[model samples]
Target: MTPFIELFTPVSIRGMTVKNRVVMPSMLTHMASVNGEVTDRLAAYYAERAKGGAGLIFPEATAVDDSGLSYFRGLSIAHDRYVPGLKKLARAIHEHGSRAGIQLGHGGRYAQPEFSRSARRLVSYLPGISPEEDARVMDKEEIERLAGCFVQAAERAAQAGFDMVEIHGAHGYLIGSFLSPFTNRRTDEWGGSFENRMRFAEVVIRGIRRRLGPDFPLSFRLSSDEFLPGGITVDLAAKIAAYVVHCGVDLVHVSAGMIDTNRFTGPPPVLPMGWNADNAAVIRKALEGTNALVTVAGRIHDGDTAERILREGKADLVSIGRALIADPWLPHKLETGQLKKITPCLSCNEGCVGSIGKNRPLSCAVNPRVGFEQRPARHVENARKVVIVGAGVAGMEAALTAARLGHAITLLEKDSRLGGLVNIAALPPHKDIFLRLIDHMSHELVENGVKLVLGNAVSAADLKAMAPDVIIVATGSRPVIPGFLKNSSAMTAADVLSGCPTGQKTLVLGGGLVGAETAEFLAAQGKEVAVLEMRDEIAPDMQGRARAFLMEELSARHVKLMTGLEVRSVDGNGVVIVKDRYGNEYPLPRYDTLVAAMGYRSEQSLCAELTREGMRFVAIGDCVKADKIMAAVHQGYHAAKAI
Candidate 1:
């Protein structure tokens, strides 16, 4: 047997044989055409992942009905018109020797109201819909119609040449809502007792099986634990799994949480790796002696962890979601004993999930070529000598890209290390996973033969001496201290994070991602920390789930949060803040330390000098604009390609 026996081993279910145990579970990319049709861009995205050697490629959650749509450009199988595009997608996967599966889902109550076209609006959508209104509750007719939609979608998937179909009965979608009493509060046969609540799922599964026959493979994705009050527990999910298997589901893909509860939807770095493995194990044991295969998803990034889960009988298959996004060739690398070459997912959620939330095409922070699959960089005939200032995320990415394109590259950093702000950002609690990116990029730089110059600042005269063909400025940014507080004896958040001395009590001046994280870092160090924000909420820039996790951590540490407070001025005693509730100005209690976490400003001095000299140069990352890791990495990759 191979070293990663459990992970590399093939598994068969209901006449379908997967090449391995590595499954690429459904993840929405929002790259479909305007009419919810699969475009070439979407097909290329899945084809790339399938080429990476995953056993089963389950494309993103596709809506079975128009009312179930969640994203603006989400894929759909609502009608026969979508069959051709889906066929192209299925062929794209099959050509790469991987089995393709489509996840049929209905957003249910959590579905976007703007996208729903059903005559009966979900009760959660409007204020006027009362319990007595037949439109509010899914009547028997609507339930039958919904089940028929699932069956028809499954048939279309089979027609599209898909090897299997997955019923998305998780994440508080329509089927999941019916399974949980928390969302299904109806007095009909679909609600009340456990058997009644599961009736909808059983009906849908049996209907699909009746239409598609038992020869075709069918998988059911379930939330093994909703992780909310009045939600389905592991025991209930086990029973549901047993019932679904009896109803003809060949596989059970175990996941956790619902959309209403953000934390469990996508567990961030703060949560432990393989956070849902225990729940999956419970369901797997419940289905023991059955023919159903169990697959688990939730931070199962690497081959080691995936193999462990299978070897321990926790799950039969491991789903790699964001990890495959960060490195599409992850499975191929793992199989070929090139595990060190794999770029791990940071779980930052700054790009993948965050992009979807903002109604944009999904992209990866580490891998910028995600959405732009058709536009790969072509090797230049005449390779130019490129000089990149600042060995930060952007600078390193630019250097690596240029070097890969046969260009001579030099990466310069004034500091002794690489990873400019990332080094400081990773110092916070539960954020050490971010350092993996720096390590991966650093290794790439050396492998790609990019000249690395550390602890050396480059000047305009030095650039002239070097005579580089093109220069990329990624000088990064500096923390901003409001002018009103500059004169006060307050240190920037960077100083505090970089091991500067701090008093027992510290007040963080901003409540964005940086400020909130800085406050948590200080609180973890036994400091009495308080965060003041001008906005109505804290960590407004962070993803919903990650922000919730951070907020909970801060609360557990007793860190104070003061939102909608404008800082007036800072003095030797303390800072003066104005409450936005009634425009009341007051002085905060005396505090020994005042930390300025009020975000950053671009450092464009080098870029300005180069522009003034009429040098062929491009500015990327913070020097261009102070944004998150996504913008910086994307800018770097494109700038390098342009050069």
Candidate 2:
């Protein structure tokens, strides 16, 4: 039996019906036509999503007029001249069994200064609202032109074979100005009273209905709650929804907090998850029993959670933006009950969030083939005897990726088990999220048919004897020490994390993430702990939010951290240290347990020997350089592709 997914069911609004509940909503792709027509690249990009199994493809907000363009060259639907290209786009989506829709947007006063019609844009024509503050103001005559532009755009959508059309009313856009009281404070008919403020959106909806008639479905996306102090509330959004549904909208798509309000509209919950679904429930509860369907989005990962939401009737459909981007084949994989085979969304935000903001292509950190569907899948040049010498994150990723390319792979490990060192790195009190990647990649190696020789011993001679076409040496690295063996009593960060053996009063030696985190873990276990680093600050390389949170936790837990302290020597007594940032030798804290996380050194003996032999080989992951898992996984992916 197929596992249930609320996100997998079909949705029909008006005459338009989609195959699945998954809707790839409009996202601003900086790709556009030079003269505001749909370019082939833009067409191919959306087609990739359609082929990946999206039931509906809403192309990025296309400007209805030249003045409405937000980017250098955005897709436009204002002119009849653009219909041929739009028709081709609709045809491409229909070929994949997905209904195509285009969003009709007018930048209005929200148009950027670089793209503004003049230095001033209309914020609102009403008193107390200035056009320059938000956008160029629309005069009475200008409003008629803009309304006509939308009507003509709807006619164009019908001609282009688009099944439905959505008016861009959310995210502080053109119609948004008329909906938001903060932006629209006019006493006129188009502003002031809630009913009056909604007039512009109502007019735009009426214009779309007039152009497409009642049979064609039309949906309106709402901000739900603006998230700002003075913005609209849930009760108000529901009232607006009821009013609009009566005005002829077919669906109510609920999304919370956009660029202007929350400023963090990532497709998924970036780290701490489940914020979006709560907001979705609120919007859905308000619109319960209306003929109009309710849809919600934001970080809806894992098929089970999505299915439960649908089964419980919390939402009619769940918009999975990042999950779909990560694996376009997610729906097909779920239907076939190949759950384990599905590449889980790591929620790293490396590909989806970073790519969208940087104006680069979309992709996923766990899945390397993301966003490059246009490029042919990377395959092995020929079946070659390949020997992998480590089984950590880097080693495993490289082996599995290469194995999938049809290479004969033999993974060798010296230790009795796999996960060299990383098993220790995974023990942090707050590193649960990072640790999950280790599990994911390890599973991938076995499922992809890579041969695991865990206990086997392999030297350089054994590698040559195997006559491998290529050798990827991932022997990893050794912890950095001021003096090796002499400081044997001082455990490395790796050993301390594993908790194999340690004393009660522990002094961690490094203020970076590893040392700080180890101190946290040990302290939480009721072991008195202090951290000493030669640098003035800790977690300097950490991201802003995580660094702030870790710092707060360290302070609250009373984990003593001493920076700019230089260590002397270690003996049975403990670590002898000094305050040497300015060369002063003041005595630092001494302890019963001294943990050294000064860092790691490359295990280059095997890598060096293999490189010197003039052999066809690749040295990747920590074996090349010791760093975070992101680097390790990234290098492993590229290295395997290169082979």
Candidate 3:
């Protein structure tokens, strides 16, 4: 018996029946060739999700016209030459009993000029903060031409054997630019009045309908709320949703925010789960009389929430993005009543969204085998004894990987608990999502038959006693304290998170991710906190969406953030004096405790001690280098596999 019956039930749009309500919505991977051709890596990525039990899979937004290309490696459907690659992608998804779909998009004024090499087309002349902001205002002829491009793209999608094609009218793209009053200021037929503003989308939709006939499934992705002043509100978006359904759209996929407010588009952990469900419900209500099904996407990561949305008629389907990236097998696991086995997406945004923004291929912090789906790990036929020290993410992941390959594994941790640094990382506000990763990985380790020994520190003698064939050390890291404050009463951020006592007023040094988060934690505890950094910005190493929300939270809590300043000296009484970049000395506000969150140093002591006894072991995670979780996890999995 499958769980979450509503999610696994079949649903039909136009004549296409999707096996379930779990939709893998379009998300950029940047896995295509530089010239916009589909690559084997991209196909394999989509195929994995389909095999994982998704009802329908929509590939990332494909450009309808070359002049509207947004990403350098974005997929394209502008010309017939691209049909073969798109066909292969569709076949890959179809082979796994999943319906394949593609989103057709044109970036409009948001298209990167470097790659497009053409003036961006806009509904009206938007005022520029600089001269380069001037874009080409589309004339009536140009509008018709672009509408034809959309129709051609839909035709190509049908020819490539895709089950459906979703028109990308959300996220401040070409169609969204014309629909939103905030960007469309023209008095022409394409803008001004609500009906006029929606003309472009209607034209494109009607054109596709005429070309593909009434039997083909068509989905319109609508931005239910622009979240901007003078933008399309819920009421307005509902009317537009009705209009689009009337204009021949079989489904309305509701999303939120525009390009300027993209943080809400791919929301990080700071945002609420299923944040856009309410707006999607509004659209569903508006389409009450139409044969249009609604799908909602935005930070939704769980079966309970997806089930509730469908049960309450908030939406007919849930389009999950980042969650599927973290674990493609999520839907399959949920269906088989293995919810606990599903690897939860941390909503960290450091991997999928952050990596693509940096022009790198998509990846997940919790799941290392994201982009490299084509290369599957091989199981070893001859099992060997493997001993792993530390039960942190790296160590646990290595243990599970090796154990699954038929290796006899034993995992040891000095601390009573698992998770290592992640246990402390989850202490900050809205960061409890990370605890899910810890829970999932730990459970998986046990299920894979990896022997777990906690509250015992591994020594060289222990390795010799066990006589393991392979040894892995993932002892993690320790906080770095400045030399001048090493002997003082200064405590590390880890100390505070570990329930160490602090005074009413606290000063946190090092305004990086750890320091800012520590400041937030202290403020929440009713402590008047301040963070001082020698750099110009706080949390510079953090991802964009998470950093933005952290700054907002700090300001709201009245936590002082002093940048371009360093600790000059501290008197015997612990009264600290600070200096700015200009060498101006000043006394800080009264504070009883000072916490050092400067950074962390790799815990390499164990590796060296083991070497002295002629024990060869591979070090992973912070024990190798004090970096992000991705590096640690990747190193651990690959290192264990090689052995």
Indicate which candidate wins on TM-score: 3
Which segments of model 3 are wrong by more than 4 Å? 129-134
TM-score of each: 0.95, 0.80, 0.97
Ranking by lDDT: 3, 1, 2
Write the number of the candidate with greater TM-score, choosing between 2 and 3.
3
Q: Which model scores highest in lDDT?
A: 3
Residue range 464-502, candidate 3, lDDT tens digits:
899999999999998998877866898899999878999
Candidate RMSDs in order: 2.4, 5.1, 1.6
Off by over 4 Å in 1: 1-3, 120-135, 484-487, 573-583
* Model 2, global lDDT: 0.73
Candidate 1 lDDT over residue span 542-583, tens digit each:
878888889888999999999988877776566565667678
- In model 1, residue pairs whose N, Cα or C atoms come closer than 3 Å (at least 3 residues apart or on different chains), thus clashing, are none
User: Least lDDT summed over 10 consecutive residues: which range in candidate 1?
Assistant: 123-132
Per-residue accuracy of model 2 over 329-387 as CA lDDT, tens digit each: 77677767766666666554665555555556554566666545556556656777778
Residue 414, model 3: lDDT of: 97
